[model samples]
Target: MPSVLKTQPWNVHRLPAAEGKRFLVTGGNAGIGYFVAEQLAGTGATVVLGSRDAAKAEAAIASIRSRVPGAKVQHLRLDLADLASLKTSVDALGPDRLDAVVYNAGVALDHPPRRETKDGHELMFATNHLGHFALTGWLAPLLVATPGSRIITTGSFAAKSERLDFDDLQNTHDYRPKRTYGRSKLAQMLFSFELDRRLRAAGSTTLSVVVHPGGALDSLTPSRPQVRVRTTGERLRGLPLGLLVQGKEAGAWPAVRAVLDPDVRGGHLWGPRVFGLRGRPGLAPIWDHLADTTTAARLWAASCDLTGVAPTFTPV
Candidate 1:
């Protein structure tokens, strides 16, 4: 594995995103999301911070305004755990189109047993994949309407642990929190790749990209109330192993690179250079199986059926 510090650093400061573009970033309150939102705001783009918590989103916006001095930042309530919230947010987002939508919100369930969201999907699957899946589907028109629009989904290196379990998509039969989380992240990457393929096939110009922050101990993985006990146990295990994790800022870089770098190609993966785990941002190779046409087509159909929202705009 390349060390996290050895990779080439991404100079996001050189990005010219301030030229009257609009962006929507989920979980923009703190950690990597905060940094991504802050940097974009600094560039003078109209940034919409998406959060389940209204207060946190507002505070995040305030913090960005303070840093950027006239940074155009706003907040919208979006609870990835609830399909109703997703619908409301999409409806309430109004007709204003977006230049990009960054799916940065995620959760890590370290709790015992397992839980499901209001949508009857596993919590990890619901929040990390389905919610974002539905949101992006709903906003496809807005994204497609804007020229050069991009959709960036936050994935994780942990995804390497497992492949999608189609038989048990919700983990109701066999539930392991970590494995479930990995499956969700893997689904996210697959979704991005599949979406890109669909868009291209339809002749759409929009871009869909996926990125993973090496190993930043950021809020991307929040301890749910039910999972706190497991987290404590894991922390104890880590103490003896002496694992060195990078900060959230380092994790935020890959996603930032995916969003701001004009050279970033659709379906490319980005991560830190060292062992591809930590350091500066660079394009990383994706697993070949992820690009399988059959898999991508099937998943897209499954998403549409599950979400009950067919994509309105075909890529062209």
Candidate 2:
């Protein structure tokens, strides 16, 4: 099992402005991604909001500009559901080296039947995992340009409930939206760990870290009858089982910690300290089986094959 470390919970008051850093935050228009961009920008980091909607991206930039008068914020068009859009956004990033890329964008299927994204992949799986997978792969060159560049991805506690179904990646055999979403997140967690291993083995300095917001109520949560019932019951009973089920700002802390903490080691998972629910930021534990070498390798191969982007690192 990966060792869990206890550390002080991080708060925004002590966060330093990223004066010299450049960051790209996916889904920065609203929810957790917005707060993360705001915090990073407050620290003087040049933040680029990556959104599927150009207008929404521009509006998000304006909102940030209002708060942080001199905030350096820009918008880059990116649609996770469209591979062509992903490629265009990456190519349009110009030649600037990126300090960090936070994969905060995700979706949950509210209905029972499975839906497909523009890329012909399961909606939840494509938006939550593969989309980010392709984006990160395309942006690897820019990430490599900077020393200590980090790729921070958002996972979820739900990942514990669903394991990757390698045979049914797209849910062709059995399409359960909830299960699919969980599987996608599991893939994300595994990818983060595997990427770190591969980077180190290839002698690369870039870091890949995964984090879960716990069970925060954000836009990603489904409002379907079943979802509402389950969530409502948890709230009514005051169940503390959900990981970090709190406000958007609190939920974004793990990603923020992963992005800014100079001492954070590669491959570490961070989240809320209180019952895996809402709280100040702390080092969150990862299940040992989540780091299985065999599983990681298989997922890595599958992601590459599915996305058509070869791993940049030559495995040793």
Identify the leading candidate in terms of lDDT: 2
Question: Which digits, one per residue and each the tens of the lDDT, describe model 1 over residues 100-133?
Answer: 8899998888976788776777888888988888
TM-score, candidate 1, is: 0.86
In model 2, what is the error at residue 277, expressed in angstroms?
A: 0.4
lDDT of 2: 0.80
The local distance difference test score of each candidate is 0.77, 0.80
Clashing pairs in 1: 1-275, 2-274, 2-275, 3-274, 4-278, 4-279, 111-227, 203-316, 204-315, 204-316
For every candidate structure, what is the RMSD over all alpha carbons to the true structure, in angstroms? 5.5, 5.1
| Candidate 2 ranges beyond 4 A from true positions | 1-9, 218-244, 314-316
TM-score list, all predictions: 0.86, 0.88
- The residue-by-residue lDDT of candidate 2 on 1-316, one tens digit each, is 3345544456656896678789999998777788788778888989999998887777778777877889999989888988767888999889887999999988887677778876688888888888888887788888888888999989888888777777777788767778878888898889889889888988888899988887676433322231122365545544443333676667888899889988677888888878777777778777877869899899888888888876584321
Q: What TM-score, to 2 decimals, does candidate 2 have? A: 0.88
For all candidates, the clash counts are: 10, 9
